[model samples]
Target: MTACLLPASTTLASVPIRFVEPGEDGSLEGLGDTECAYLEATGFKPTAGRIALLPDESGKLSRVLFGLGPSGATDRNGLLPGKLADLLPAGTYRFENDPDDGALAVLSFALGRYRFDAYKAGRADGQGKDGGDDVRLIVPDWIDAEDVERIAAGISLARDLINTPSNDMGPAELEAAARQLAERHGAAVAVTEGDDLLEAGFPMIHAVGRASHRAPRLIDITWGDPSALKLTLVGKGVCFDTGGLDIKPAAGMLMMKKDMGGAACVLGLASMVMAAKLPVRLRVLVPAVENAVGGNAFRPGDILRSRKGVTVEIGNTDAEGRLVLADALALADEEHPDLLIDMATLTGAARVALGPDLAAFFSRDEALAVEISRQSHAVQDPVWQLPLWQPYEKMLESKAADINNAGSGPFAGAITAGLFLARFVEKSTSWAHFDAYCWNRSSAPGRPEGGEAQAIRALYALIRNRYAA
Candidate 1:
């Protein structure tokens, strides 16, 4: 269930949350002089993540002070207020002054309150440790409370899906989740499962997923008016990649449940778009599968035909994400939508190059890349653009087939993978691929050490601005 962030009453009666910068004491301006002096004498210093409580004349709690690190810090994680959400006692709070980014502060607060106790005992009642806390944020006059709630709801949905264990989050479960989202928004859903994939010409999706006892499926959902601008989204939903016949080491397979993060992310974005009722024909395609190591698994050196009719030689069975995505992307491209986006947890190279915080996206369209970058900075959802590098196309050359599933060299693995997927996309279409690490390594202010949602906010901002009616 999604956590409630905004307060029921819009009137400002809650305690004020004052955000202070390092070496700044002016944030306590409205406080009683004695209370300010007491804070100072008690060794209170303005530093990031530091909080101080204020008391009234009768010694009852009055206001809160939170540190915002040094002023002019370039790399501020907007989720700082989220720390307060976790620490503050059950009560309502309101920012004394408008935050640097009101939307981010609201989002961070809601996200920080998230707890995934789905499988834990006593959680069947839908209550967690933080559930009883009546903590809420008074929506700022300038901020749209509904918009923030919508985006936060989407993020929570993605996190819940990504955090679920593989036992309960198989291909079928994923399809059901998609259906639920579509039904909630009055969208249409169509799923092609099992041998139907072969009949539907999604041979590559079938070839990679045939090994698992659970059937593989392609989840396609559509919403909005057909006459509007077309926006197609494709996500790689590798539910649990056991590396197929090649198999991963135990350490490498630990986080395999998050392999479907791409699928979760697209669904989150779709939710936001549909909720906002953007003037665009939206379609989401997710190739949901588990790459297990059963006897029927496709083996290295085997050739398989894709939906686009391009034959691919399997250089490594572990590189199964690109195979399933190939068929899905091909299907998405057939419509030649005005904007096409595909996101996946596709490569370790992306993590090495950009780390886990910043997602690496590839785009052939310079204008779209620029707009996305602009919005990324505005929203603080970071994404770095990598080149398509036409020269690297040779790295995927295969003598046995039209292309190879894995690149020839170890270097530029991310780029080569992008190049391989680029084969399935039409050159005339405006397409962008995001390689994201959907898991957080450690606990941060608003983000906990678990599955996370990335890149959706900036992309939503871009779409909302472009197709604004």
Candidate 2:
């Protein structure tokens, strides 16, 4: 993890950071005549995310001006100050004005400071030499510094796991990460590994991962009070997806290491829930595997029995994410949790429909869908709801099995995948499925280009609101 939030200090030379709204240059009052004239001469018209450095009379760095766009305009990016973390020079800084949402500003600032330097040279301490930018923010009095740190920690955990390569992050390594998380939170963890999955009734999980040298395992972590509201989260942990017998092209296999992004995301969310001590009994299930091609690899046209007793015909071995998730979701559903949610970097169709910035989620429960949608906008996590559409259920029909792993046609690929997973989940459970790209195609203000954490924040907010302690 990178050193993001810094402690407040009284003696350090602090620069005042001011946010200016468009057409509101008057807000720069009390900055002294010389500084104001310098800003005006430089044509600093308060454009959104634009920054201007101001110097003092002695030619020393003084204050900084950041544009917040317009007053009535909605900032879908949430915190505007996050961009400043990378732009500001190595020094301590303080906010000049009190923003409407102080916590988000500080949280975003910490998020923007993140850098994945794990494999980079000179990172003996995990953070590289450039890590010592020494950029610090004096958090506003109204904002809880602890809360900001907690959220940033969760986000960093997900980013770190996703950014790691497949060589160092196989199924065994993923289980290790979960164990470390469980240890920190005083949670109990049980792992069902290798051939043991067969006896454990996770045949689909076993079949999907039988080819890999690294054994397949289901990571289950439980935390919080036993009597509290039951909240279960399932994540697809395909550590590397070679597409099994149906191998992907060289271009398509580049980002296969991030196939386990869903597991990383759920673990991150679980960390936040446990850290916040949310009044809920949280259960996290990750079906960790590597869909590699070998002699023992399951082939296309093979029939497999799921934990839910539903037989599935393999339409395509490449569509293995849902296979592993199906078993885990069935296990979670058996307990009939109050809320069951599964997230995966499942389909390219989802990316084509909603793009990389937005996540596509599906749910049969209308009220739960509305709440998640509302919270997504509130947190700026950006999720859109797609219907379960029972009519599309026929798309997954098979002559030999109860269902097919993929749809019969290219149309509605993401929807069909959602419907396939829905078969494992009990009808009475309030379940939601997130089909997220989990990778940013390009770098944005607070969001870096590599493995991004989507929907977790919004889902966390929803859980906190529903089970406020």
Candidate 3:
């Protein structure tokens, strides 16, 4: 989605988009008698999703009346104003009066205009000149224009990546995307691919992706001063998951293209950090792979040695995301980073527990957990903390190997998966794991129905505040 915002410096004779709550239209002083009568005659009430286009005596567009619903309306989405992007005819418009949340107002307006039009091709990569490009929003001085644009661009990149089909976004293509992002920020990246992963002690990563023609690889990205505090992010990049030997049913495989949502979202957050020039040493590790079934595919019941020297018994080949994340998390933990965070679409149980909007997170540090919750609510980027339930750790015990890749029971599936990854994260100062569902089930306000970047906004806010110079 292009940032559909005019530069804050724009001084053009633009039309004002006035906001009105229920029964507040009479207080609007700018409207003349004819316009007031027109509003009453038309029965235009400021209810949610309603917009009024007011024309002047010359019959030209002059103003807009946007609805805000009741003051404490339960379902009043903060991004509700985003509807204006599509509702209004192509023209330059400005919010005459600042809304209660100006930041969210502007951000939603830009994102509301998002469209995954790369393959369809009105705007390549959802950027450049759009058919709706003329629908420009005037950026007010109270909101940071550059910050909002950076965020919108980052999120749009993630959506574009996740929306792409696996045929065009396999392991190698994912690496190319990572490299492109690194190049843009002048960051350095290294990749260990194919059998080299076995030599590099990333056996689990190698085993999961060995069957695919697009050889699996680990992509590492680093930026900022070496002496600065280290923040490491590890993402499970299973570009397409067919569930390997225990292949998913036809219905289950429908949206497997977004199995690498963790990678896309981490890169989105990384983009924001680089663009804003945040003060910290950043490292992103993505185990890019495709979990496919073939003659060479790793089978259930196979025991694999991981980078951390822990052995895992594969009880289910479908549980492949955590296998790749294990090796990368172990490598990340080796540096004992100030903060270590790993994101993955590791379990459906997470989605069942928190639904699609709230990201389910597990953290070892109490303070970090509290701060993340606080930041999440403050920014309206919701996340709910799920405990690192110690008792559930026993469910992953393996008589064949040191641990089992899949838990013995279905109960506490999300918690047990976090337990599996936790075995390799012994050295990091603080660690958190997020199980996110990166696709939206339906369109609403600023959030569209396709691939969505979850929890990164809240994570960015926490990182920015915690590591500020």
What RMSD value applies to candidate 3? Answer: 1.7
Q: Report the poorest 10 consecutive residues by lDDT, candidate 3.
A: 122-131
lDDT string, candidate 1, 1-469, tens digits: 2344655465646888888886654776778976787787788776878888887788877888888788667545687887877778778788887667877987888778777787787677432232334777777767787788888878878888899999989999999999999999999999999999999999999998899999999999999999998999999899999998898999999999999999999999999999999999999999999999887999999999899999999999999999999999999888889999999999999999999999999999899999999999998888999999999989899998999999898989899999999999984368899999998898787787788889999999999999979
Question: On residues 1-469, what C-alpha lDDT tens digit does candidate 2 reach at each position?
Answer: 2355555544556788887876774777788767877887898877778898998888677898888788757662456778887899888888888654677888888878778886777566442121355897887666778777778888888888898889989999999999999999999999999999999999999999999999999999999899998999999999999988899998999999999999999999999999999999999999999999999999999999998999999999999999999999999998879999999999999988988888899999999999999998787788999878889989999999999998999989999999999899884469999999888777676776788889999998999899987
- The TM-score measured for candidate 1 stands at 0.96
- Candidate 3 per-residue lDDT over residues 1-469, each given as its tens digit: 2447888688877889888788774546879766777788799878877888887777778889888888879656678888787788888888898765777888888878887766774445533222257788888888888888888888888887898888889999889999999999999999999999999989999999999989999999999999999999998899999999998999999999999999999999999999989999999999999998899999999999999999999999999999999999999998999999998888999989999988999988989999999999887888999988998888999998999999898899999999899899999859999999999899887887889899898998999999877
Evaluate residue 326 in candidate 2 and report its C-alpha lDDT on the 0 to 100 scale.
Answer: 96
**Given candidate 2, what's the lDDT at residue 310?**
96
Off by over 4 Å in 1: 7-13, 22-25, 125-132
State the weakest 10-residue window (summed lDDT) of model 2: 124-133
| TM-scores for all predictions | 0.96, 0.97, 0.97
Candidate 2 segments whose C-alpha is farther than 4 A from its true place: 7-11, 74-76, 125-133
